[model samples]
Target: MYNDKVMKSALESMMFVWGEPLKVKDAAEVLDADKKVVKDLFLDLQREYAMMGRGIRIREVDGAFQFVTHAENEIFIEKLCTPVKVKKLSQAALEVLAIIAYRQPVTKGEIDSIRGIKSERVIDGLMSKDLVDVAGRSEGVGRPLLYKTTGEFLKKFGFASIKDLPDITEFDDIEEYDEETPHEQLSINFEGDADSEDK
Candidate 1:
């Protein structure tokens, strides 16, 4: 049996790890507790986070709970986001990004076949930068996750939307877009790291 304190800790951990809103009933199922109890505990957490005067707070939206930055911190958040450079793509990350942008809801396996190398790391980097997201899981044998460029990708690439991408007919071949020189390098100012390798 979960005590109130333990259940509160578990709820907070789940919300943080998920990084998204979770339904009360869903939290209850994961916690193996009563829904009413989970709801009450979550409410208590909401009040506690509010009183802490921290940069983050938990909020309920449409009956789901998520941790969000406090409204008072929006200015600082925007300032931080504003400094992110636009042209930091490495040759490998660029190739993988292009593939995701064009061939999305594509799976890792498909990307590997197209590029002829394992791209798990490059994909991870893109995800860390918030450019790529899991669109869904494929119905294939392994149910691998499908990747897609996020709205941030559109903003960075100066595309009004995915439909604004250059027409497919414009490129003689999709693979050709992935054929940049292996040694080509680009670095982002914010991340201060060496250019990504094509490995």
Candidate 2:
């Protein structure tokens, strides 16, 4: 049986390799331990990082966890290395993403109707960026594919889970909006070596 110290150490190493949020259930299965114990251990690790004010911190999103730099150290990190620039998401992309995020497992038809425009290109872009993905096929007329936000969404938005989305009034008043690309840009800075491919 893995002792608490050993289990925690193993979990830390696993999280570092996982890069993405490590699911408690997956970790428990690998370690042959109960999920509850693993979850508590993950929580303990999270608390320890916070208490120690470590430069690299663990963040729990939903039931999974991942390592993210401390927001407090953003300036120092940027000064130390050139930050990778992720292409700024367009307004249309933002609108489509919002719709998909709010009404996840939503159909393409539903998204188009809500936006009053076709979002094929925008959805494709979101998919390529790993923000949205196909959840499954709808049982409707043509059995259209269902789209939903992924774990990357939670990490980028700093949300613990989808349930953390704040209360917002419906977009029922959205009668007809032009699909024009606005000058507004939402900059997202991700930590990594700058790649020319991203440009």
Candidate 3:
């Protein structure tokens, strides 16, 4: 008794329960359905929600899916909810974020090279903020984990995709980080309150 309608309904409930982006494979496994079938159904639901202009919409981040409010309805939601204090990002964090955004799927070693400092803490902070995540393992050297920006990054930056990022002259003559002590782990600690105009 495989029913598209029932499965879709179940999927919606599942997404509601899974607050974070739910991976397609997980949904497929739960439904005992083929991965492609589940994915197509998810796409179908996405279109239906948009076509009908629903207040709640499904958003795909990376390969996972989650429910999100319609962008146009943000004002109303903002007014309804109490304004929560936002966490601040240090200058060091911002610098590391920029490097990762521009040269994504990059390793910590490569990031250290571009910024001339260890970025372990900054990267961890970005991961906590849901701005970036590990993409996969690289083949070079010790097969380090590759990092890339997340969909939340796009939502925060108001970019449809990474390709929309403004072009800039790439960093020149970047040095390779030496394993022992590549640029002492210096941290730029500067935290400033956000202006009223900024998001």
Candidate 4:
């Protein structure tokens, strides 16, 4: 009662509906067929797609299969979508981001000491933008959430890795170039942006 063509069509339908990776056993269970049959049918469809010059292809990752665009078509997709994906960051956010990037797993208190301000809102914004994330909790008092730059930060900044960051020595004289308050030195732009702790 198992028609090969009908089974193949059903497999495609299941994959499309899932909208994510589909495993061989999962597809077979849904179709009430042997796992080997499902895998063979999936392979057949993959070959057919390649031969048909389709923009999308089925790929296996970690023992699961999913539909993904061909690598050659990525540039076109980026051209169509990069602007909306790239959001601008404020100066304060950048400073906080830089500190987290260079000194990962650091607590907000540490950041406050270096930048001389309470960075609650700035850190919130960075988290919302997916540029920074809570790496873990510190062991000391209160077990404060430690923060670090995310992989998305590297991708957005075009850094291959953290080590690709420019040498800190190259920026040695940058501090002396400005005569503003400590807030300005760290480039944090917020109301009460000046040091209020010593106020």
Best by lDDT: 2
Candidate 1, residues 1-199: lDDT per residue as tens digits?
A: 7899999999989999986567899999998999999999988998998898877777664466767776567557657665545346787897788778768899999999988999999999999989899999999998999999876564444343577665565322654545342112112221331111110
Using TM-score as the measure, what is the rank order of every candidate, best first? 2, 3, 4, 1
lDDT tens per residue, model 4, 63-129: 4455667656756765775444334567788778777876788899998987899999999998987
Error of 2 at 141 (Å): 1.6
Candidate 3: misplaced stretches above 4 Å?
Answer: 88-91, 107-109, 116-121, 127-199
Residue 1 lDDT (model 2) = 73
Q: lDDT score, residue 161, model 2?
A: 83
Whole-model Cα lDDT of every candidate shown, in order: 0.71, 0.75, 0.72, 0.67
**What is the TM-score of candidate 4?**
0.47
- Candidate 4 or 3, higher TM-score: 3
Report the backbone clash tally of model 2. 0
Model 3 accuracy (lDDT, Cα): 0.72
Structure candidate 4, residue pairs in collision: none
* Residues 1-199, model 3: lDDT tens digits: 4799999998899999998778899999999999899999999998898899788888765576777777667667668879766565676777687777777889999989878889999999899989889999999989999999887775555444577665545434223333312111212111211111111
TM-score of 1: 0.46
TM-score of candidate 2 relative to the true fold: 0.82
Instruction: After the best TM-score superposition of candidate 3, give how far the Cα of residue 177 lies from its true spot, in angstroms.
Output: 27
Superposed model 2: Cα runs more than 4 Å off = 169-199
Each candidate: how many clashes? 0, 0, 0, 0
